[model samples]
Target: MVGNNHIRSVKNVRVKGIACAVPAHVAEVTSLTDAFGAENLNKIRSSTGVERRHVVSSECSSDLCVAAAERLISDLNIDRSTIDTLIFVSQTHDFTLPATACILQERLNLPMHAAAFDIALGCSGYTYGLWVAGSLLSGGGSQRALLLVGDTISKIVSPADRSVAALFGDAGSATILEHDPSAPDMPFVMGTDGRGAKNLIVPSGGFRDRHGQSTETSEPGVRGPYDLYMNGAEIFAFTLARVPALVKALHEANTASGKEIDHYVFHQANRFMLEHLVKRMKLPPEKVVLDVKDVGNTSCASIPLALSLHQNKAGSHLSGRFMLAGFGVGYSWAGCIADFDNVWVSSLTVTSNSETEGEM
Candidate 1:
């Protein structure tokens, strides 16, 4: 059931570079002790493994993504005119009318001929973006693609809500995928179940519930209809039931091709959940990346952000057969086994606006 019609393989596409950026503002989880009490805050911190996270005051997800894209374009010395495809993936877009990708294309100085569009997704968006971009390139229409993924979940979460406020952060990333004749094929497995839609969603703000918005606390100190509501138990159960199968299908497909995965970089959902997955799958702990201590679950930006952070911390480039999986937020899950050969991953950049503030 996991691999019948959901598996896809794209060839002649290679990732050229990746860059990530976060806001300059930092929010400590323990600073909420007055709202949730010391014991509750401690419990949340220990379980989620989130000590602090970067947040945005006036900046949106697009701002952070533009900062990252600017850095990536500069670092790789990529010609702006050569990028013919622009894919911006996120749940929080700049506007509901004009696509944010169009604005990004103009801001990044990409050619007007570039095909720009937006993908409304979260958590599994990075892998999904890669799939779409790779397909576009491999199909012969596009030669180079720029995929931007990010989310500012903090803007949606109620500050007083302990369930989500302490578990989410803001981040953005840009990844370049170009056509390469000698690059190995990238196999991907993706699945989705809309039954778990309400389990993690904003109850209002869309067309279905446009007039149902409310800022009043729905529960005592909890979120409202317009805010993000996550049924944690349901999400955990869904991940347990779905993600393992997704990973299994990806592994089987890769192994059939006589290739082994060198690293596992899953969506940095949380510390406890990632640790549990690693143990249950019997994967090598050293090969898996579990770095959610500083930046909390960043939705779509998590995967690319993790790769950039890992490469910077190791003080070297990432070159290997990498297995990247992203699961959550839509009850959507995707995993890909790709060969990364000296992929250019820039160091983590922190920004307040257009200029780099510092590194976190």
Candidate 2:
């Protein structure tokens, strides 16, 4: 269940193509008027260093996934029929009935024989999805798989819920992974704490509550209409308690590879969480890639989107190893710091004629 290494070994599978999509509706944080106000926006801006964010309009998570996947498949010039499997990971799903992967498979015109399904994960979903696809390829379970992640928080979010709205943006990313002989099982370290599940979640609007009418309520406390809720303090405590240990483990993985991790691309949660982790880990500021400028916190898409954009922008400096870590929602989290010195990611650019949320 492994390939040697993307960097340490000469036989790493290259990340041939990557594509990301965001909805048409975009507004800078400064666009927030008296509702959020420039003051609140400035505070978030100061903390997250984000200027703008994207939102999905009249679209569900599956719609964005379908659209994004189509764009990715076309742009990469991949024969959709060749995708042996489709793996989608996201906390926000399409409908409760059908798996979003199957829905996307139909949308992409891939062969029905090409297995498709979904993984219910949060921010770390992108990293977890890669490792899942990689393991399948290595174990001879599937040849090449498409991994897609998208969020529709723009619709789910209660405008009154300032906490989540200020940070999250809606987007999806797709990666095309093919089998390579020498790559190792991308060092996977994942965990969960059911005890903290309630810290970040939508308390209603599920099978559990489909019949149970949501009790009317308002915020400053538990509110109804049951929007995405988060106890920022609890989440911080949970992440602070968990991620550093994983960071240390990542360091160990890098040391054994004869190469220090040159960069760390963690989830684009927020700046407070990021700064705290960076200082505690003693990692260089440059090593912590901050791709959270315009897109804010894009949930499952954050890490891959970060990788997609940073690798595109960094150009020749893209070599060297980097750590990928994501923590949030599900009270579940995961980390994978791989040796990718030999990996070359094709830069993804969204053009005016492209099939992105805006252009389309």
lDDT of each: 0.89, 0.72
Model 2 C-alpha lDDT per residue in residues 160-201, reported as the tens digit of each score: 566766677887777777776665435667777799887787
Name model 1 segments beyond 4 Å from true: 1-5, 213-217
User: Which TM-score value belongs to model 2?
Assistant: 0.87
Candidate whose lDDT is highest: 1
User: Clashes in model 2: which pairs?
Assistant: 3-182, 3-183, 3-184, 4-182, 4-183, 4-184, 7-341
lDDT (10s digit) by residue, model 1, range 194-292: 998978988777887787655433665577788898889999999998888888888888777776788999999998899999999999999999888
lDDT of 1 at 263: 92
Q: What is the lDDT of residue 26 in candidate 2?
A: 71
Question: For model 2, where is the 10-residue window of minimal lDDT?
Answer: 1-10
RMSD after CA superposition, every candidate: 1.7, 4.4
Q: What stretches of model 2 exceed 4 Å from their correct place?
A: 1-14, 211-223, 316-318, 341-360
Cα deviation of 188 in candidate 1 (Å)? 0.5
Instruction: Tell me how candidate 1 scores on lDDT.
Output: 0.89
